[model samples]
Structures are given as C-alpha cells and as structure tokens.
Target: MKKNILSALLVMAFGFANAQGTGSRFGIKAGVNFPNTSSDFHENENLIGYQVGIFSEIKTDERFGIQPELIYSTHKVENKFIKEGIAYNNDVKLSYLNLPILAKYFVTQGLSVQAGPQIGFLMKAEENGINITDHVKTIDLGLSFGLGYNFLQDCSVDLRYNLGLSNPIDFHVGDENYKIKNSLFSLVLGYKL
Candidate 1:
C-alpha cells in the first residue's frame, strides 16, 4: 500500500513538472501548526506541531490560479481524564498526509485569498508512548481557507485554517453517541522554483 502511494506521488510530480511550461510553478514549504479538536470530552488542550510540503501552482490568468499541495502534518492534543479519583493526562500525537486543492483569487498584486477542500490520510497515531492507531478513523475530510502574500518574486508566506468536517472518532456512551473532529491553524513560509 505504501509503495502504491509513493508511485502515485511520483506520477503526479512528473505531471506537474510538465505543466510548468504552461504558466505553472513548483514550491516547497515548511510551517508551524497549532492544533486542537472538538469532542464530547470535557478537558482538552492544544499543542504545537509542524508540517512540510510541496505544491504546484497552475495559473489560469493573472487573477486566478489553482494550487495543489501534498503535505505531511503532525498534531498533538492533550486529553485530561479522571481515573478512579485521580486525574491523568494523555498526550495524543497524530500524523497525516494531507492533500489540498485550492482555488486562488488575487485581490491585489501580491495578495491572494484561497479556499479549498482537503483530504488527509492518517499516517500514525499515538498516546504517550503507546500506539493507538485503531482508535481513530484513517481518513479525514476538511476544508481550508487562507490568505497569502508573495514577495521578492520567489518567496511567500501564508496563514491558513483547516477545519475538519468529519469525525475521526466513533464511540457510544450509554445510549448516546459521541464524536471528535480535528482542526488547526498554520503559518508557513514557501520558496518557489
């Protein structure tokens, strides 16, 4: 399964590279993430994480473009729970391979706004030092909205929010069902070639 995914990415890279001749560009990005989740649980806290990615921007005109990115993102959430009369903390770390395809609208020379759909494949999940991969769903569906600024022709910075639409957790409490969805804010720097 991993080999298939790697093959697909290679094919996409080649296709995007060929598209550069028709007003497209490739870029590399790295960023910091502030991640959290919405859940039925009472006590939760966010932790700082990180992401790295590659993207291709295909320009249709001076004012409009399409940007597709493949990113490896990590998120950590601290869950506080009470066990028998004691309170304890479990730090959950989740990693994903995220794919986002955004439509960009240039409002000014260097400024743009983008919105898009994103899909994330879970790569790893852990609580403390133990693996808890099976406790959460493997696929995440989300939306992304952001503002970007391009400077010095080749350098850019972006601020984005990713909102997860689907619950990653599935469980029942007595006769009630509970859900949990992940979300995050990202600040990233990019260089285009």
Candidate 2:
C-alpha cells in the first residue's frame, strides 16, 4: 500500500512538471507554527515553533490549480502536571516532514482560497533530553485550509490552519495518558522562481 501511494504521487508529480503552459511555478516558503495541543489529560502551556518549505504550483486553468508542498514543521508543548506524587514539567519537542497537496481556487487576480490534506512523517520527538519517539506515532494525518494573496513580483502570503485528525501518543508518563492531537496555525511567505 505504501509503495502504491508513492507511485501515484510520483505520477502526479510528473504530470505537474510537464504541465501544458508557462503557468507552472516553483516557490519557497517559511513561517511560524502556533501549536495548540488538545488533550484529555495534559494541559498545553507555552509553545512556539517554525516551519519552512518549498512548493510547486501547476495551474490547470485561470481559476484553479494544484499546489504541493514539502515542509519541515515543529510541534512543541509545555506539559505541566503532577502524578504519582511527583510534579513534572515536560517540554516536548517534535519535528515532522509534512506533505500538503492543496487545491486552490482563485477569487480574483490576487486572492485565492486553498484546502488540502496533509501527511506528516514524524522525524523526531524528545522531552527534557529524553528520547520519546517510541511513545509517539510515526505518521500524522491532517487537513489544511487557508487563504492566499499575491503581491508584486510573484510573491505571496498564505495563512493556514492545520487540523490534526489522529491521536499520536501511545504511552503515558507517571500514570496520565493524553489523547493529544496536533493543531497549528501557519503564516508563510512565498516567492516563485
């Protein structure tokens, strides 16, 4: 199944790379992520991170297009709690390689709306100098919805919200299990080349 999915993605990429007109573009984007972890056990405290990526846009027409991105993003959470008579303050940091395939519809010459599904591959997870990758899931599924506006010289600004659809943790610390899901807001600047 994984091989089939990879093969389909490659075929789509090839088709986009050979798109019919001069409307295809390659771009770079970078931004911050405001991570909000919703959980049943732990309360999320101070969290901050950033994301950077590259994308390719293939226009199927004047009003519609497909934009695919390869992004490196961070998810951090300040988990403060007490369990088993021990107080713990855990600063969890996670990294992921996110693939977002967006369908874009232009509303005007400079504005568009985008919605997509994203697949995130977990790269690393750590908490307070301890490796916690074994307690975290390796893949994450999410949906991204956003708006974009183009500026002069092929530059654009995009604001998106990524809503995670799955629980990622499998283990508990000190007796408390968290049903945590990843939610993040993104504001990225892109320049086409």
Among these predictions, the greatest TM-score belongs to 1
Tens digit per residue, CA lDDT, model 1, 48-154? 99999998878889999988889999989887755456676778889998888899999999799999999888889887969988888888999999999999999
Instruction: Give per-residue CA lDDT, model 2, range 1-193, as digits (tens).
Output: 3564465458556755775355688888999888877776545674879999778878878999988888889968887776777777877888988888999999999799999999887878998878998878888899999999989968999999999998886556755566778889888999988
lDDT of 2: 0.83
lDDT of each: 0.86, 0.83
lDDT of 1 at 120: 83
For residue 118, give model 2's deviation from the true position in Å.
Answer: 0.3
Identify the leading candidate in terms of lDDT: 1
Show where candidate 2 strays beyond 4 Å: 1-16, 20-22, 173-176
Report the Cα lDDT for residue 97, model 1.
88
For each candidate in turn, the TM-score is: 0.90, 0.88
